[model samples]
Target: VGAGGETAHLAYNSGASTQHSPLEDENDYEESDAGSAIGQLVNGTNVLAIHGLNAGATSSDFHIEPQLIITTRTGGGGQTGYFATATPGAPNGRPETLRLPQTVTFSRSPGPFTGSFQLSITGAAAGQQIRYVMASPGGPFNADVPAPTLTSTLYTGPVTVNSSRLIRAAVFNPSNGQGGEPSTAQYLLLETGSGNNTSSFTSPLPIAVIDQHGGGGYGPGEPYKTSFLHFFNRGPGDIARLNAIPDVFTRISHKVRGSSSAHFPKRAYGMKTRNDQGENKKFELGGLAKANNWVWYNPWKYDDAYVRNAFMFQLSRDMGHWASRNQPAEMFLNVNGGKLDSNDYWGIYVLTEKIESGKDRLDIESIGSSDIAGDNLTGGYILKIDRADEDETAWQTPTAQAGSEDRIVVVEPEQEDEKPEQIAYIKNYIAGFETAVLADRAGNWATRNYQKYIDVPSWIDVHMLNSFALNPDSFRLSSYFHKDRNQKLKAGPIWDFDRGLNADVDSGAQYDPRQWNGTHFDMSWWKQVWRDPEFIQGWVDRWWELRGGALSDANLNQIITTMGD
Candidate 1:
């Protein structure tokens, strides 16, 4: 497809020379800063679909999902080595020729994407090599967005970049598919890093951003865990700004875990600190995070199909992949509307090294689910949490059932038939969803309570995997095969991790499918090691900011009822 190409060029120092990209599509999005609106993709879902032929015409792209089109043509049966040919507009894939540009650059998200965001010069001959660079704000950004180059005319501004998302596309043209100064001006969304607003994706940050607290992580007494950019590697300490709307919305998603985390808190307790405004104090609210609420990524582990999105989610969350790191100041409502702070609205802001070792956890808090609710600006639902336990025999099940307050275990009620596309709809909701990175667990780390022989903090286990969402696995890995926090057995803390859905049937080592990817909730260790409190939770309260005050039970009920029969 005359679109994107390879991904993940994380080295900030290696300085690979400019390269070229011919993409299948140059998909750039303008995300809504309010509750989820129509037209925009959510929950990492794709917004583009392969357009089909007219009623009279009989073409394949119109009949099936675009992903299937790529599969049939590329992998097993019909392998057409072409660019953007199989995109929505064409089934047998349309063939187009356009004017070529002199210089080009094709950057991409660190992990994965649906279409190629490649910037390129069309009409170049087969041999001509257009110089381009596929840059990312984050080192791990190798998402599905293919590579391409920017137009020479637009490459006028000075390419300024110190951290991730600070990008510029410099490409030298060689061969065009056809040759000569072809037709068509360079696409706008996929253009060079020009103009004050032309910065597309975020780039990677320096390594030091992770250990701001001397490798202690964020938060007081809890070690490190309060940097808002823990997920993307930038924060107030680094970017020195925040976008009130986007920042709070993303943070809310991280806290709610997912749409399914909606429900009355079994109990709510203070975290020992207060918001700068002193309105929204820190606290741990307990409830179920429906099954399938895997939010955090298990990076470096690509074998599990369900967890394939681990790296993708990590990159996607950073939001700065191909954008300008120098952002303007902005403000929005906080729980304490009277008081507010400045913010940078670029994209996801991940911290470094702090949560890299996600395997650490404790008995109080098992591998916390990322069942993060989507930013509300787009009319999204509540939690779509990962399941922690299910389908266990009397002997095989863990001695403890899921819940914080009442150990009142209720066998899961038989679920009625689901409405059409319910799973797909819910899945779609989270794919484009971006979470926040705020909050710091004050009082003390889980170790504080455990060592002091204090009562189990209610926040320790607030999510409900069995009753709320569906677990793709036969049972919850964290529930049973669990151990204690000894011999360096770190107790886990909760963060904005997500579910573990495998890639589609068409997505493989080569041939790919899907418009967007789901959030990465899979853990680093598949063998139930994320229960460490110091490791996980320490980062949770701080990574993403919260959207609304608390997860409302009314919203949860409304969401459940939305699953029409």
Candidate 2:
């Protein structure tokens, strides 16, 4: 068989070619311009071999699909041929093999012994084909054997296999040769006695643990500590289990996230999947696309309804902007070795894309080298109007901007390593713009407008989003501004909005759109620019124009409904 699955008959130097099979070359599969492997038919058999190829160690576990075979030809005069497999075996089979559940944990209720109770089902699909396999590890039962193995109970309905302390039950997909991870090694005594009927069976969202044993617990201002995080999602074949799902080797640090909601019970974390040491491994959580670094956002303010941030982010994208991508997740902490202590329910959170300079993320230049100069030093910078933590190195504006107390922080480029000239360049550029804004004369105001320093349309869109959503801390804090070297400063990729969408503000009743002016919050320079009659009219004109399109009620309503689903 050639790399493209075309069979070629090559003259064998001897009489009958040795009978070969695809499985023989399975591990040795190699890629060419033609595909992965190439082979030729030998005497009565197909043998596959790569020319001068080194079959190095591969992590691939190729599960051949199940197939039925019928003899195409029978022995005749000097001829005996059988039908050969036409295609490479499919891994896990046609619909894909099912995987054993990653976690199975049983907890018995302490209520009065009742021989009657329901073992509830949550994740099970209504009509999906599923079966239960109960096995005792290191005992008389094994999952590797054929069905009806001794001491193992294979049932089509909900199981009551708690008789043996070590009986592990997993959802089995016989057709796909996959089974979920067996439940933990212990049995739950639902009732105090052997004859008591099994009561409740609840499938809680799988627990995830971020063990920061080296650094104790995470804090608002803490150094990055080496951490191991493991979270499970139901897949591989419809079974969910612990540790059997995704795993991430990360360096985690808890930097306070959100504006006012930073004080909420749940804290946001900044996780670096690839730290200074360059650990590039990544995992997909909640079935979201894969990425190395992530922000585990706890939307504490929104409580169980954690869609605010995801909603806001989707709105930004629909309005033709690049915003953080988010997925709702059930976050838990510190469950190691089947023990859940010092753990937290942590509740629902928005697992979001961490704002950074990367292809999938901010998509800006990454000027990380210490010796960076010229265009390299100009940007790929992620500057923000966020409150500076103690560890953050920042530059204070020479003249205080009105209404805002916090300083702008240079979030990217690790300030300590930034060249003095590079640091001075951005500082002076911002300062020069501020000076020009403050010194704008009536006639020259348009030419010297803050518009020259920023992407006016983006700023307008961001303002409209904040205004429409009535977010209290919109322009001032948790606000992000970035530029890519030669590009003008663009507003947002918007952040934290748990406080948006009619959420109450702790300071006051500031959710009213009329009361909250985008200009009045912070960046006093905005107030000076707002005074210019031309800029004000442009802001209003641009806003109303967008209201007819992206911000239109119909468009927004559709976006809300689609995203909610």
Model 2 scores a TM of 0.59
CA RMSD, predictions in order:
28.1, 16.5
Q: Highest TM-score, which number?
A: 2
How far residue 323's Cα lies from its native spot in candidate 1, in Å, is: 37
User: How much is the lDDT of residue 377 in candidate 2?
Assistant: 66
TM-score of each: 0.20, 0.59
> What does the lDDT come to for candidate 1?
0.24
Single out the weakest 10-residue window by summed lDDT for candidate 1.
432-441
Q: 1-565, model 2: which lDDT tens digit per residue?
A: 2333222443322122232244665354433342222333344545345322112235244333322223435455332222112245642232223343333333432111223333322232333233334333223322122232113454444445333222334444445444444332222223333342223211234334454332335555555544445454555454443423233323333344544455666777766554323346565665656677788888654534677777778788878888888766555453122222223345656678878777767888877656356776668677777677765667668776523577777777766666677677778768876776776744556565666777777776777777677776676777788888877878787887776787755655664566655443244446566666676777799778878887778988987798765
* lDDT (C-alpha, whole model) for all candidates: 0.24, 0.54
Compared with the true structure, what per-residue lDDT tens digits does model 1 show for residues 1-565?
1112223352323321333333345443212232233335365435543222222333223222233122123555532333422255643432223333433323322211222344333322345544333333222321111233434333333343222231223333333332122121111121223332212333333211111111121121221122111122235545422211122111111121112322212111111112321223322211111121112212212222322222322222232111101111111112111111111122221211211111221112221123222321111111211242232111111222222221211111101322223324333322211110000123333233232221122222222221122222212332222112212112222222223334222235223345233111332121121244553563355233211212235433443353221
Off by over 4 Å in 1: 1-80, 88-90, 93-165, 168-565
For residue 379, what is the lDDT in candidate 1?
Answer: 18
